[model samples]
Target: MDEIIRAAGALLGQSLRYPVDLGGSSRSTVLRCRTATGGSVIVKAFADDPEARRAYTGETAGLSLGLAGPELLAADIERRLLVMADLGDVPTLADLLLGTDPKAAERGLLEWARGLGRLAACSVQRRAEFAALWQHHGQGLPSWEDEPWQRQNVDAFLDLLTECGLTAPPGLADELTAVGTAGGERYPGFTPGDTCPDNNLITPEGLRLIDFEAAGYQSVFLTAAYCRMPFSSCWCVYQLPADLAQRIEECYQFEVVTQYPDLAEEELWQAGMAQAVVVWTVDTTLRLLRRALPQDGRMHRTRRPVPTRRQVLRHRWTSALQLTGYPAFTSTMRLLLSELAAGWDVPELPGYPAFRAGAGPEAVQTVNSRGPETAGG
Candidate 1:
């Protein structure tokens, strides 16, 4: 223990106090530590993997907004160790969401978005550099689109539909393929590949975003893909109050409009749905099929699980059908709807009860009685 502390101190150029883990990504260990200099700091030590160095570089540059970038206290690039100021009062948006008051939660979420907007606007000049960083860190690598992560999701949804034995509206896969491909190209602003609620931080000053390992330059619509994961949950989207979902969309749109005036209303609406397909496709595969049938896990789009494919197509259909009625972006939405319907012929798979709370956010949304707006996501 002493030797480890000594090593940390030597690396930090100060005496080491104690270390407290702040759980973060699989690639880095985030810690709360005190330096002999009598100051607190947040330390991020990369795993054995060297890719983390590029991530750190991107995050450092991303923090140029000057609001929440922790001070770079020390770094040992060879060891993949990084130490910075620990912003003490900041709680992640996920933590803040536990608040009892719905209004407060909404406000907090909005604040988080505001901080993100600031980052997006200010970081515009670093666009090329940011893209380069993602490429270096594997953030820009095409998603394991055909990997088991995707197939599993498709399987889970199909299984759920089979269990319910609902006469599913047809053509799900075609719609998703079209939307996914098109949305990837058209989204407006930078897409933070990792926009899970946990990635947002709320400080007394407002919201500050952290964890830029997956931060990269992408079409703005792709950003919505990151944000729309909650809707894919059968539970949260269905169970949560409708007002909450509406507020979320409003806040998200407000931020986008504020950042890019040319952002057309149709574009905003299309981006939201387009991103929705991207997120749902990925999350379902990663979280669902992977869990039920581990051995079959090969990359998503690559290996096809005939059974699981039907289930995922079902969920995708549920989402697309719900969005079909909305007035905006009818043409594009129709395109997705038609594509989604094409998958109805897939044979149903049997396994896993329709997602319940334990199934994750998609299941959670389903329980809420929220509109397809929230549920289909």
Candidate 2:
């Protein structure tokens, strides 16, 4: 660690002090350092792992596009280190969500949406440039909403349910396959890939995105949907209220249309919603399965300080069911929700009231009848 810090200081041509370790994934180490001249900067160093190397490379490439993120001050690809301007003590959107102020939380959420929108808008206009960088450096980057990717997601979800001793809803696999196939034609734009609220910092200027290790060109709808429903895979899973989620979706759509005037707004929104329901449902289900199944070394570490594992799993399950209320997938989602409610223990969850199977016409109906509750519930 000291050697790396020394290398960073040498790269900056200055002495440094008070290096603070900022926790990152197992594959990376992040540090906040103060230069001898009293300027603050962030330094990220990747492990020797191949995926980590690719992520580091991708981050460098993505930042070069001049989209939304901290300013890159210096980079040492060979050393697997990147120095960027410090974003200061600004809280993340996740922090705001956990705070007492609902209005500030809402503002942070909007800013997060707008920042993503601006990044997508700006990158779409320079797709060629972003594409070239991705081609060269974006290995292990997610292919969001592509046919193969979607199929893998569906199969994985099915496998997970089966492993958990639960029978998947009839034709659920086929329905998911069809959704994936429909999105085969790639949407054009650059995606930050991982847009978890914690990956975004709320600054005086607005929300600034960070962690572009998974950055690449993909469907703008893929990310738009992701913003709408983050699912369980991320620790930053605080979702906006239904009305606010809708408004934010509209805000993102408006920004996209402003940047690409010829694009169809309704089509984009529909596609985004479709992607959201399918992808988030599958991913969140998979997460629940992992929690139920045996432990793996990779799953041992706990990242987020808030929301116990049970809380997150419960949120994913209920939120996915709530998504079924959408008009397009109502029937299919209702069936899945019924099966899940019957086969799984939803009522015993902490803070969640017991739900009787026949209390309502459908599982989602019951969820809606309960009215809005804190995300923790």
Candidate 3:
């Protein structure tokens, strides 16, 4: 610890105070360091692991994109260290969603959507720049055209289900394959990859995204689907009502079109919806399968605290079921849901009831029943 502090201090050209370990994943070590002058900074040190190195490289690229995120103070790639401006102990969007105040979550979601739109817009204009980053980092962006990757995801899901003694629907693999194939060619844009609410911090400057470890170029709809499902395979599981989800989608679209007038709004929207349906369906299925069949070394191995596996699985199942109610891919998802429910122990998530899709304005009315104007104000 002292050696790390000294190295960071040397880079900052100043002495440092005690360093608090901010639990990072297995790939990196994050420290919140206080300077002798009382100011603080975050220093992230990547491990020698290949994935960790790639993440460090991608993070540097993301910070260089001039997006809404923490300011990079300095970086030493050889040493695998990044010193960044501390964004403070602000509550994350995830925290707000878990809090009692529904309005805060609404505001956070809107801000998150807007931020993501801005990111995509910027990346679209600087496609060449991101391409170079991808090459330099040795981490290529995900493409719907990548048949092998698509098939791998599908095969993994099927294998998981089969291992759990659960048989997937007859056409399930085919449906997923089709979606994956179509997704390859549509709405190609920048994706932050991991869009969990915890990655978005509500600083005084508004919502700023952090942790660009999984950041890369991909279909815009991939992220849109992530937002649509709120989050898949994450501890934070907050479901947005159908109407609210629509508004958030609109918010993202508005930002994209506003930034690049030459792009077609309807096309971008449709692509996002298409991509969202496929990704969410696949991700949700995998989550449920994992829950049903817990294997050795299958547990989540992150430093962040999370709910019990059972609770996490229940949240993923319920959220995915709610998404099936959406107008897009309704019949297919409905059939999938029925199949899963038939053999699974679907439990009620505490504090959240099972949400039916297409509930109209009433879906979000209860959360805003106090006053519509203040819901997201």
Best by TM-score: 2
Alpha-carbon shift of residue 5 in model 2 (angstroms): 1.0
Candidate 2, residue 28: the lDDT equals 82
Candidate 3 residue-wise lDDT, 342-369, digit = tens: 4445344443122333222222212111
Cα-lDDT of candidate 1: 0.47
List per-prediction Cα lDDT, in the order shown.
0.47, 0.62, 0.61
Per-residue lDDT of candidate 2, residues 1-377 (tens digit): 78878988888888767988776566788888889988989888888877788778778777877788888888786787878888887677655554545677778777777777777777766766766765555445432322245567777877766765666666676667667633325555676667875667787888788888766766666667755665234654544556877877777777777766644557655755665566666665565546543421121233222344444554555555655324433443454455544444423322111112222221212111211112222
Q: Per-residue alpha-carbon lDDT of model 1 for 1-377, expressed as tens digits?
A: 35445555787778877876665455676667787777787777666544555555555444432444556566554555666677674545443343334455566656655555555554555656654543443433332222323334444544544553333336544444344433433433454445544455566766655565544554445444333434243222212344554555456656666656655477557655554555464455335433333233211221111133334434444444455433332333344335433434544332222222233221111111111111112
Better by lDDT, candidate 2 or 1 = 2
- Between candidates 1 and 2, the one scoring higher on TM-score is 2
Each model's TM-score, in the order given?
0.62, 0.77, 0.76
| lDDT over C-alpha atoms for residue 66 of model 3 | 55
Model 3 RMSD in Å is 7.9
